[model samples]
Target: METREHYFNRINRFGRISFTIFFVLIFTIPTIVCAAYDIFPGLATVLKATLGLFLILTPIAVSEIVSFVPLLGSGASYLTFETGNVSNIKLPCAMNALKLAGVQPASEEGEVLSTISVAVSSIVTTAVIILAALLLAPLAPVFADPAVKTATANVLPALFGALMVSFLAGGDAGSVVIKGQWKAIILPALVVAVVHYLVFPIKGWEGVTILVLLPVTILGARFLYKKGQITVTPKVAKD
Candidate 1:
């Protein structure tokens, strides 16, 4: 008897409440800790310490919500942000689930599957963080080694590289996956190469690598779209 509308309504109602509680907790915890330690400092000092982060993270947060919410739907967005890791774990996990399930993000099945994937990602991330905390003392000496430090420094790069490779390898030529135009691949590759060789060394553009790449991608895609090379075909349901 429950229609998809009713299902989404229920999920949205609960998800809003959950997000509200989490928002309150995040802000409250900072105040609570400051009060307990009597370390409020001055308003200026606090702002000085936090201003850069506030400016940088605010836009990134807004952009991420815009980028991710459509794919995650109502429930999973709340859960994934609360769990705190988005790019590394939550997104890839949800993406893989969608790939396996063969559903478009707007579909009912995609919504449910995305919710489940994010929930599981949250649970696993919590468990891993807890276990790592518990094991930290025992692992300290090993982690203190020079070689270990070097490897730790490279971990993020390696992880991202692997993710990129997986994504590129995922597209079959017949399927024409993910924008599916020569412009999408060749143009971006040239842009990335040029940026790395020429633009990346500029001090002003440092740390906003994604910001640069994103506009280039959109422009490239739009150009292809105008040329009619990029078509809007509905996804075929997998058997």
Candidate 2:
């Protein structure tokens, strides 16, 4: 059997190689397109067009790594980032799997389950995408319906609301319950609310806001933990 250290090392190596290949392939598409059309944009023009988005998304990417990696582990993090639709698909899938499996995030069992769940989620997402593409023309009228649009728009909010309820209420069977976690969340939630209402709209500054709030959330949790307000009690097995 491979040692834990060896397993992690192998995962790191694979992640590095795969990410490099993925990066190359991503640029290769545009490179090929430009070459084929002999229509390469000027460097300055390209930078001007992309610089703002790059700035905005870079911090969000870093924040996702900081926030998600611990919960997802090495293998799943790589797979989730590579496959995209992280918040909408990958994260919820992994979290739901962990909850159902009664595994703590960052634990060995959690790592395996997260990886498998993310992999399966990726496969399913790809299949759905292909199916959608094939059905796009046939489904266009249905998709354009106002009710369908409204339902689609609300899907993400509903999904996250359900996830939050499971975590906050500790209602899921076998899911680990952290006592006083809500107290920690109160401080950050208030801060976010204040910022959203008083300072500026959060929608435009989401990435930057998340990066800033991360430290606040950590400090709040730490303070609560130190005060014995936050306790990680082991789940009681049901008879």
- Per-residue lDDT of model 1, residues 63-141, tens digit only: 6776678778878888887787787779778877876665657578778899999998888888978987999999889
| Winning model by lDDT | 2
For each candidate, what TM-score against the reference? 0.74, 0.90
**Every model's Cα RMSD, please?**
4.1, 2.3
Check candidate 1 and list the clashing pairs.
none
* Alpha-carbon runs more than 4 Å astray in model 1: 145-183, 201-239
Clash totals for all candidate models: 0, 0
Q: How does model 1 fare in lDDT?
A: 0.74
- Candidate 2 segments exceeding 4 Å error: 171-177, 235-239
